[model samples]
Target: MSEQSKSPQAPDRTPRVVIAGAGMAGVQTAVALREQGWRGAITLLGDEPHQPYDRPPLSKAVLLGKADGATLDVDFPGLGIDLRLGCRATALRPADRLVETDQGPVRYDYAVLATGAAPVRLPGTEGLSGVHLLRTLDDAERLRPELAGRRRIVVVGAGWIGAEFATAAREAGCEVTVVEAADRPLAGALPPEVARYMAGWYGDAGAELRTGVAVASVAPGAVTLADGTVLPADTVVVGIGARPATAWLAGSGVALSPVDGSVLADERLHTSVPGVYAVGDCASFPSARYGTRLLVHHWDNALQGPRAVAENIARGEAEGVVYDPVPYFWSEQFGRFVQYAGYHGDADELVWRGDPAGAAWSVLWLRRADGPDAVAGAGRLVALLAVGRPRDLAQGRRLIERGALLDRERAADATVPLKAAVR
Candidate 1:
């Protein structure tokens, strides 16, 4: 008999998808898959015992006691998702298509890695009481009482998390001091000239902003600067940064980014492993539009990346779905609503909108191009940072997606609507 004639017909069965994390990305992936009409089995695994929750609130509402909890508004049982809370995925066995968890190895037809990121802890601060890292509900909860007591807080790193934490600490009547190793606040995220204006917000909020200061060591009640400056603190919050939580994928044959250990996912969110996909903070996807691989660790990325992942999984490669997105994120700090959209690189031209020292202002970043029309090319809006200017951010985001060429003077005019600036 011919090989084709001898082949047995395979029985049709529902696909099983195992998601390794139960944070926003993991939960959203499961929800999106179901909403996309995938009647497959979904096993959502999380290391935390608490129910899946939104993380953004952990820094704002939850920390300020404005909200009780950030638990996600999802009925896991009703959705028929296998919500495995408090279960840790120890390793990935790609050869057998199984996720080795503390509970047991769970088999899957396809697996989605949404492990997310872990907060970078301050060195030599381990086992020290009153030191915390805010990345989860438990971390926020632990810090809540400290804030309620109106303790003196020394926040390390003047990044988003640190600024937000300081805002909350000040609101809670705590003495706040933000220490950054860089020369200005948001040094890693914004230009010094832009970040210089933001530094004033800390002082306006009654928090001391100390930049270009390195922490030599962190103790229970104080942080010692490299210059031997001892900053008194009843509580210390480390907000330096976070790294992708992909240590479990070691030896699993999954290709991880050498830069940040993020899973190297394609434009479609598929990992090096044939049957596996990665999304959110734990995954870095290449953006053909930006000509770079972006590892966006924000709520928007988590919310948006899932749609592409789910579609590709459901419709397959023929769908040609890509996960390239205009990166957007917002932060509430010093009584200001700060929003940013799109990717910006060194080559992007920075255009100022309105007075930076004023209560409301925005910054437009245009992509640089060469040629006779270089001036017009440089006016192509690619990214925007709006401080207390939501309309600018809202309009700028749309214009960026449209690849709108803007007039520099009109784009920088606070009186003009960003959409109208496009020529």
Candidate 2:
């Protein structure tokens, strides 16, 4: 082949960043790229046909039909983002820098894995009628009518989603019964002393909360317990848990955590593979602040991670910024405003600000002490949870970030400001 006869070189195309999911993390990544001064071609792919929306509302307002939808207020065209709906990425070919989607192969200069998570389903209930999950817009829409009909709902799992869904169902006049296999609500999340305080919220809302009771089987119109006790259920809402949607990256040269299947990103949100990054529920990063690997599945993590990923992408690898945030999240359930900040371990010294049975109370987790700043044998604030006390949460979150040591006696005084309690 003569040099002159050789195929003409392909035209130089604009550099592109392909985002795999259109959830909060993916959408924000595309937006943040522009904000971070990345003037490149951005292509975002979403499996759902509807506009990308918030997930938290799916369990609350959307489930009760109080709102039509919770679509994000981002303008894709205005932002120069090519948003492709109903196009799911099936595989990632790192060698070719191509993402194989259900639609077609999409080329990318860089790729972001923000596919979020998939809710864990009950065994043998894939196609069973009256069984549903509240993870997506369509899922919420399908469940709205069910809740509006005032059906007897049996929610499996007394986790955050279960409690929130029960709140919505009860608000809609449904007979809500939440069954948990553990000994208490949020056994997987909070310590028993704290979680025990929440168990009363369900019964107060007229919903039967059955803890330490395993579901032997789940069928339409009923849920059978391990003890052979059958609870009448018109509908079954499964909120057991969710696993990161990182299975598509298998063999794509991305390291995934065996514990949770999340992409094992470094401190800078960059994955094992060059020119590729991961964020949101699909990714777990080492938290030097917490001294452990953190897998955050909440909206806040999904909201905060993209900014770091975007900034790192805009700046070259050498100048990338580190991502180590003080993780925060809030929950509105059981007619109370609940907030939590920082990470706490069972070994932490537990301090009560007020009576747990009271309508408004807060609990602070202090590090076990012998430090110079130790007060009452506790050192530094590790974590804090407040029920109907936004002030404590707001002030304590900052203290946790600053690693402040709280004067135990002052912090235990419900009237004292958390900042004042800092030693």
Candidate 3:
């Protein structure tokens, strides 16, 4: 049998590709496939009844009521893909190359798992209508009315969602109390100094920031602290974090990471099984910056990863480019726009470009020292974190790996471009 003859010939029909989860990654995958001239029948399965929409805005604009939830509509029919909304995908059988959903079994030549993550609900708080989690448009819609009553809103966990919710609650005239077991906000992502600066933001925003305190329990009227101190709350918003929605993949031969239950993928986002790929919040791949497998649950990664996967899926091993874009994320909290680009886990030194106490400042993390204040090469400015400075983030992203020690006097000028700090 020759190379082409040894294999059973594929049917002379458009390849059927079923994508589970209609989030950003899945929708974009469908769009990219069609745009790449993939004539295959694409079926997008979403557990939610609504169309795909940008999720980042949910915690900020949607919660603040500055944007309506209904305005979120991703044109699916315009892309000529079958949209199966409000349906759940039950299982995947790689041997059969078919996905079992509530509607029926969907056989496919290729399948994508962009299932995304599920909000972690605090145990014992279920059935309490006041308790909420912000992961979906519907979740934001349900919690908006509670914001208008000036209620005491207890935000559990001080991660990005918690901080954003605290900001929105304060804007809604509600008393916001943030409880975090960590010593500072964003302790997992930012340094202690930077985290402390953010801790002060809650107080400055007129919201209570309680650090190093574990949430013992949530009652109807209050949140009980670890020390038995009760914080009155009419609404408790849980932002503890998210776990991958890979429950359906159990016993399906797809390897998932034990660390966080994320699907393990190579640079091309291919799972252990061939012909199937994973991306977005559900998958983790080795990152050159961190030198280990990392799970980046950000908007840009979800939006951009599909193109790489689509090319690989369409052309197989002939596709050369591996998915290795710089990781970036942003947040709006306490009337400030915080943006971070690159990863700083291994940075040797952290330098502030501006006064932290001032209205605007950005910090650049340099991995290597090229003499006194010069660091160059890739991964040098492994990460740049900025507060209230979007343009600085844009400039710093380009300056990263440039090996230039920032001059505070020059940086304070406010006239220097972020990339020109050293140049």
Residues 232-348 of candidate 3: C-alpha lDDT, one tens digit per residue? 888999999899999999988999998899999898888898788998999988876457787989988898789888887776757534887678889988888899987777345
After superposition, the stretches of candidate 1 with alpha carbons farther than 4 Å from their true spots are 1-13, 372-378
Poorly placed runs, candidate 3 (over 4 Å): 1-13, 70-73, 369-379, 401-415, 421-423
Model 2, range 263-294, lDDT digits (tens) per residue? 99999999998899999999999999889999
In order of listing, the candidates' clash counts read 0, 0, 2
- TM accuracy, model 2: 0.96
* Candidate number with the higher lDDT (1 or 2): 2
Ranking by lDDT: 2, 1, 3
Worst 10 residues of 2 by lDDT: 1-10
How far does residue 148 in candidate 2 sit from its true spot (Å)?
1.0
TM-score-superior candidate, 2 or 3: 2
Model 1 lowest lDDT segment of ten: 1-10
What is the TM-score ranking, best to worst?
2, 1, 3
- For model 2, name the residue pairs that clash: none
Q: After superposition, how far is residue 199 of candidate 1 from its true place, in Å?
A: 0.4
Model 1 pairs whose backbones collide: none
Task: Please identify which of the two predictions, 1 or 2, would achieve the higher TM-score against the true structure.
Answer: 2
